[model samples]
Target: MAAIHRLERTQNIPIDLEQAWNFFSRPGNLEKITPAYMRFRITSPPVARMYAGEVITYFIRPLLGIPLAWMTEITHVQEGRYFVDEQKKGPYALWHHQHHFEAVPGGIKMTDIVHYQLPLGFLGTLAGKLFVNRQLEDIFAYRREAIEQLFGSMN
Candidate 1:
């Protein structure tokens, strides 16, 4: 069995909680923050807002432009506070992600916690150690820049 890996990131958005929540809650908005090189594209019908039990499907070229089909269901939602999305079909053995928003002194604090496990047991472990972690970091870095451009700087 592969070991479960965790990744968490938090950023202060220089925007009101409602605006932050509204932008992030829409499934289609993912493409705006994602790196263009990854070719992230949503296959599911466009949604204005997300709710529990919403199933989202996408095609992503995570590596070498090789397209992969990924599906995730919004398993939990608490309106503007938080939401959880769980993988139903994807490359990973498991994927559960939580998005949380809190109104802070300056702006909104957005947090992302992702728990994921790769497939193929030991081979998966090796791949994760060699590249997957770095890939995830790069993706998030891109997201931070994209979001900052959209919502202005937090500092």
Candidate 2:
């Protein structure tokens, strides 16, 4: 079995907690922050808000323009605080992502914590070391820039 890997990132957005929560809590807003090359799209019908046990599906061409159907279930939610999503079916052997929101000095602090395990045992470890980690890094970098664009830099 491959070891589980973790990635965490935190950023401040110049927005009120309610605004941040309102935007992030809506599942449809995801594609706006995702990179275009990934070709991310939600397959599930529009949801006004996300709640525990909600299952969301998406079609993403994250790697070679080959579409992959990914499904995630919202496992936990605390209004205006945080929410957790876990992969029900996806590329990773395991994927648990948590989005945290907290009110800070001037705006809201958003933190993302992701835990994932690749498949294929030793090969997965090798792949992680070789390029998977870098790919993840790039994805997060794009997300950072996209968020900055949407709300302007933290002021």
Candidate 3:
């Protein structure tokens, strides 16, 4: 069995909790923060609001420009507090993403926690050490910078 990996990122944005939640809650806005190289796109039909049990479809070229179709479901939602999305069909053997929001002193404290596992047993484990980890890091790093650009850097 391959091991599951967890990635956590927390960033304070100079925006109110409502604004932060509104932005992150919208699926269309995801492309803005994602790296251009990944070519992330939401194939799902447009929806104004997110709700539990909503399904979203998308595609991306995470590695080597190989396009992959991905589908995820909004499994849990707590309004302005948090929301969780899990992979229904994607590259990962498992993908569980949680987005959390909190009202901080100056703005919003937003955090993302992802639990994912690669497939292919031993090969997957090896792949994680070789490529997947770096890819994820680079993606998130781009997201962080992009968020800073959109919302202004935190103190």
How would you encode candidate 3's per-residue C-alpha lDDT over 87-130 as one tens digit per residue? 99999999999999999888989999999999999999999999
Q: Give the whole-model CA lDDT for all candidates, comma-separated.
A: 0.93, 0.92, 0.94
RMSD in order of candidates:
0.9, 1.0, 0.7
Better of 1 and 3 by TM-score: 3
Q: For candidate 2, lDDT tens digit of each residue in 14-68? A: 9999999999999888999888998999999977777999999999997789999
| Pairs of residues clashing in candidate 2 | none
lDDT of 3: 0.94
Tell me model 1's lDDT, rounded to 2 decimals.
0.93
How many collisions between residues are there in candidate 1? 0
* Superposition TM-score, candidate 3 onto the true structure: 0.98
Question: How do these models rank on lDDT, best leading?
Answer: 3, 1, 2
Find the 10 residues in a row with the least total lDDT in model 3.
146-155
lDDT of 3 at 6: 96
TM-scores of the models, in the order given: 0.97, 0.96, 0.98
Model 1 residue 129 CA deviation in Å: 1.4
Best candidate (score: lDDT): 3
Clashes of each: 0, 0, 0
Candidate 1 segments whose C-alpha is farther than 4 A from its true place? none
